[model samples]
Target: MATVILVRHGRTAANVQGVLAGRTAGVGLDAVGREQARRTAERLSVVPLSGVVSSPLERCRQTSRILVARQEHAPGTQVDAALTECDYGTWQGRSLGDLAAEPLWSVVQTQPSAAVFPGGESLRAMQARAVAAVRRHDAAFEAQHGPGAVWAAVSHGDVIKSVLADALGMHLDLFQRLGVGPASISVVRYGPHRPDVIATNTEFGDLAWLGALGPVADAPVGGGAGHGAPRADEPAARKLAP
Candidate 1:
């Protein structure tokens, strides 16, 4: 059971403009977006990634390239359409403030399972395909590289959130409760019993600990010792936000 790190693509021009650029062509990462990706890449550089899969969108491709470049031995970026952004259809290229006025917007926020973009796909369909693609790739990586292997999936915010919701066994309607920021990392390891949500929407942390982790059948009953043992002088562990 390899661990999959879900990485949302860096911010884009559309993001700054509050526009939905769903499935739109030629929308690349903005300057701030590039910097965000580079910072994330620097954080992940300490760990060796066996595979790096990304959405076909330009912004994601750019972010993936940065991530692979920083890795010591990251396999080249592989594109997967199933990980692409949800098609916003008539809502594409529209500003968020504007889209909020649409009748379907309420359903999208409250009950995504029944929300379908006009002339595009439904939120339920997006989650199904995205989850399937991630699981498929996880199984393949584990079989080829062994269970200790780690991989990455660079995708859109909603796509990643949907996958996270499914991993957490939450219904699609509650998916909106999850927040996936640009260049953030969320980890999920598929185990025999169930998927473990290791981290979610993390912007900063020491992920080097992951390199030493191996597959486990079940989570520790008491949250297990935090990663590795604490240092002798380290004060009693206190919950810290990352």
Candidate 2:
């Protein structure tokens, strides 16, 4: 069996503001977000991680960096686009309240499978992309590190839940039932036959008694120094398109 640790990125301004950031370029972790990531890193220090993979999104990338930097593992941690948040499509940048005020938003919440985002992706599309990414990551880890290799993937809340739902063999419509909080950790095991979930919605500091390290110093929270657009060479995971 191979252990996969799924981590949701720290909180972001968009998250706190109730805006759908999707694939927006500038959205990142705020102060509280940074602390969340650091705490996550401190907690996972006890796991014998062989590799760390992250979404190219600033939020997940930042969290992955903090975790890996604290680990004794060697360099070359991978950043892939496969681990990205759901593309909110036309809903990107719109506040939840504003969207809720619109009639179409009701359809999205009530009938997501059939409701299409005006000029954007549907929930079905988002689930497909997210599930594919998780499968791909699992295959890659199995091929490279063999069984029993513990790997960590830092990604978005929605994305992580979607993946968990897939692993659980649940329907896409039940995605809402899986809660993935910022900087929270979920563990899954992929064996020769099937995938099994070990835990969910776990906080970093809560595991301090497990002997995991504490948060690092001066790590940027909420958001980090802004960067240019996500690298073009990276595979496209779901994104909030323009």
Q: What TM-score does model 1 achieve against the real structure?
A: 0.93
lDDT of 1 at 86: 98
Among these predictions, the greatest TM-score belongs to 1
The sequence of per-residue lDDT tens digits that candidate 2 reaches over residues 1-242 is: 55678899999998888888988897778999999888888787766677888889888888888888777665357887767766666778889888888887766655656666777777777778877766677677767776656788888877788788888888767777779999999977665566766578888434322222221123236654323333333357722344
Lowest summed-lDDT stretch of 10 residues in model 1?
232-241
Write candidate 1's Cα lDDT for 10-84 as tens digits: 999899999999999999999999999999999999888999999999999999999999987768568999999
Candidate 1 structure lDDT: 0.91
- Residue 178 of model 1: what lDDT? 96
Model 1, which residues run further than 4 Å from truth?
230-242
Residue 27 lDDT, candidate 2, scale 0-100? 77
What TM-score number comes out for model 2? 0.79
lDDT of 2 at 67: 87
